[model samples]
Target chain A: MKNFDVYVKKQLLEKYPSMVFFLVVMLFPHFGAKAFGLFFIMLFSLASDVRQKRLDLMTFLPLNRRQIFWMEYLFLCLLLSTTFFVGLPFAERSIYAWLVLVRSFIFFSSYFGVIISAVSIGFDPYGAAFLFLLVDLVLGGIGSSQLGPTFNPYKLISPVYQANLLASLVFALILIYMAYRLFTQRGGER
Target chain B: MIRVEHLRKQLGNKQVLSDVSFTVEPGTIFALIGPNGAGKTTTIRCLTGALQADGGQIELFGENYKNFSQIYLKERMAVVPEERHVFRNFTAKDYVQIWSRLYSKWDDTIFSNFVARYSFDLSQKVESYSIGMKTILFVGLCVASQADLLILDEPTQHLDPTVRLEIMDMLKECASSGRTILISSHEIFEIEEYATHFGIIKEGRVIYSDSIDNAKENHRIVDKGENLQASDVIGLVGSSVLVKTKSDVGRYPRLNEIVVGYLTGHHERSLSLR
Candidate 1:
């Protein structure tokens, strides 16, 4: 499995330039507000590449389908965690900074959601990205309207956002588990 | 030894392999030959446990593949698949290091020697290597792993003749050292030279499987001095016959020739009837 890890690392390193660019943009003041959205998009795109390449290699090695799935999940976690740590030092020291970090985690979780949804529905990269973006946009719009203020943590603008942030984190964990199972079940077909 | 019994695999509506069964003896070279899209690669995938078969069983070294632990089975076998897929960003040395960790019995010295012998640059990224170079690298990795069984699908697909010969030599050396090899190739001539046992797959079925010498002897082209339809002549021969051609313009007028081909080439030794 060490060899397999190296293989995954080599692939991740190849895509490091794009990752760095995404991180830099997220750190920039002008783009900081939109960082969560961009991060969500980038995660799905990068995860798709990772999933496909790992699947291809699994075809050659004497590995079972389950091992391949777990390896990929582990790789995804490692990559996202590394990127998050690296970007931490550059974040601004303010209330918004903590919010940004929390939002970024939510964004990352949503990307996993996209990946799992894609696998479950057999959607390719383009379709998965489009679906994720569409869902996020609609959800964002709904959360901004007059009808949404009652449930809208964003409009409350203070302590409510913190509560929503915690809720979102919990929701993300649930989704990650669901996605892991869904993707693994679907991956057997490949 | 590797044994497959009644293995069946389906990809949606298409049945990739049905009731495919064969066995490979230790220290022998078993060649699986078939045309493109005949499920040769699919069969290899199933045997290697990369793709799960819908029905049937694969017993590698006495344990059923489905029941066997992946790490345990992997330690006993290495596969060089038809598609030469490798990490493009990794150098040759890096690639070898990664492979070494996968196999419990990897030999770094032997792998290094193979790299040098293949004339591959250790520092060059895998993406920089040509198709032939990539193939050589894959072959080298399989050989150096020192696994008991090597499963290669079209191992020499894109290699030049010289490189192909070198690979064959390497296979021969490995076999002599007590490693079993199962290879599939479209090049009949190359397979014919190296394979001790032959298996042919056609449309997801094992059409033929036997020793190479028996396959040649059992199937023979017989010339006759009379032109006749293939269907008409089929009843006259005791064994299965495939008619080469039926034409009336030859010097031997009314002559018809039939070529005998074996379905399995498993019959006992018989004296030449011709």
Candidate 2:
């Protein structure tokens, strides 16, 4: 518990960058489209801490591997959820807006969760994260076409279709479980 | 205080440690001596719980290491890792505060005095400090932790001669106070001066291990003419042959000579096999 407190404190020391993006996305409402991009970048940075040998510093401390893994994953979740709520009031108050927000959260969270797992499993963090981001962009572009409503991942998880939302939720949970399993099983370094 | 048995580890495609086994009695300074790529760092990493052993047993404080909680190991031991990494964003003052919170026995007064004595700027970020300063800061933090055991990997590397002596002296003092110290280092000459016991590792296996005095007493450098058994000869050093004979037949080897003899013997044996 003491180690967790210090670990969180260490993370807060670098909160400036994340805070800056949060404020920009919240105050300057027009930057909403680019907000996801900035948020992903923040997520990439946080996930890459392990790759940067920052985890090596903690390994010397009192924290165990499980605590390190969960603390990090939960911290990212907190950041992502905070960003989502801060931009909520600016929503268009339509089903489409709600679907876009929820689906984007599910998709990106699962995507970055896999990235963190990949890094833990020995993939170079920079290459894996960027490649995943590129894949997300390609999917988003494809989903934004004439068949946008049907194919668009950001529009697919709608409340109208409980099955669709439920499937997405289940898929996200599975991905997260897989990630945690891989991370905790792998050795600290390659 | 620390015991390792048949410690094995594999990193990527290489089997970094094969059978590293040693013990450090409480209050002794045990130096792990080996050449580069000889598994010293891997052994240290495994001991610090940074790298789990693929197959082996490690016991600390008379309990199986696997059975001890992570916090328990950290609470009783302080480590100065070979990487000497720190949270670069933090200042010295921040480190003191954070480490104080993390380690139950952390002594702020000790670290504060160390900072003042070294004239280090407590407000300056660690990233701004030179390599030597960073090493000093890490060593200072380990000392201030006041743990019962200290595991340091090359604590004197990258340091000036004066600072190296000072740090060794500090470690000597720590050992004298009943804290066990385990260090992996290439500074054989310096380690010879202070280490109470040592283990020589080569190619992932501990080839020789014993107390300093016993090592000297057991090995001798003799002329090449005597009918020495192949098993008794340790290594060839120029015209002289190092032998492991208990009889008082030749000049006793110094600590460095014994190390060189064992390593050179291993090199020759490998070359002949090749």
Candidate 3:
């Protein structure tokens, strides 16, 4: 746990400037544009091991590949989701809007985090982004399928229903778990 | 403290590590040396678990590598990878603090002493330091971690002669404390002074490996003008031949000579005493 915390600090500190810039961008009213940029910047940040090519180095530290992967995801989620939830004032007034807001936050972050795990396992991030874009457009079902009436930031923002926040959270958690399982089984080799 | 057997890895179309094997007992400094592309880095990668080996076994501290807990193995070992392994944005202080907190064995006295010895401001960003300075900082922290085993690759590359000597002395001290050290370096002469064992690689295969004393005993450089014909004709001078003969009559080959001879000389000889 201590090692993971140190790793999180190092990862965030390494990309501090870009992270700060993205956070500032999130504060603007252009939620759609900001989120789009967020996808690239956040995913690029996922390449924490790419720059130093230190996947091997990290193995020498007191952290497993799974722990390292989890911390990175956690760092990105905490950093980006905080920005996301801060925009909740703009959410529409609907039945249990607060539940919807929290659910959507968990759901979208995990969804995209799973999508980026491929990049962590050797897939080029830009190429992964392109593939992700293709899949999201083609399947039209796995991600943000129903842009509910209460969607605030964008007409395409996947909105949560009344008390279904638990379901949404459960769904994303399952996907995240599966992603981590597959990642570790591969031995974290690029 | 370390054992590798028949480790093999194929990267894309090339066989980067083919049948590599070596063992390092506690308190020994083993130098892994080879020509460029000889798979020194690949071997280190496999041992560190950075790259999974396609075949063979590795045992660290008598624990089968596959069965050992990742955190347990990591806590007992530390590595200074090839190049650019530093967090550029972090100041020296930040880098040290991170490792200090992560490892229970971290020696604050050593860390502070190293910082003072290096005489660099801890507040400066790591990227702002020269490459040599970066090497000093990284090596200092790894030493401070006080791991049971230390694996370093090209650790002294950018360092000056003075710093390199200091670093080598520090590593020797580390080994004296019962720690094991595995180093891969091109600075053959420098390592020869401190390394107790050697694993010489040639085109991805381990050609020569043994305790430095045993290596010296098992291999010798026949005087160039010797009248004897030997099987391993490793090098040739103006009027003499360098032979890897086990003959007690010939002088022991230095580590540098053995490395060159294995990489370039022929291994065919018929003995004739001078």
- Per model, kept true contacts as a fraction are 0.39, 0.59, 0.67
CA deviation > 4 Å runs, candidate 1:
A1-4, A26-54, A62-64, A90-103, A143-174, A188-190, B67-69, B214-221, B225-274
lDDT tens per residue, model 2, B131-191? 8898899889889999889888899898999888888998999999999999999888888
Q: Which residue pairs in model 2 clash with each other?
A: none
TM per candidate, chain B: 0.82, 0.92, 0.91
Evaluation by lDDT, superior candidate among 1 and 3: 3
RMSD of 1: 7.5
Worst 10 residues of 3 chain B by lDDT: B265-274
TM-score of each: 0.77, 0.85, 0.84
Residue by residue across B83-144, what tens digits does model 1's lDDT show?
77765467887777667777778888888888678778888898788888888888898998
Superposed Cα deviation of residue B157, candidate 2 (Å): 1.2
DockQ of 1: 0.30
**B70-177, model 3: which lDDT tens digit per residue?**
577878888888764666588988988888887789999998898888897999998889888887887888899998999888889898888888899999999998
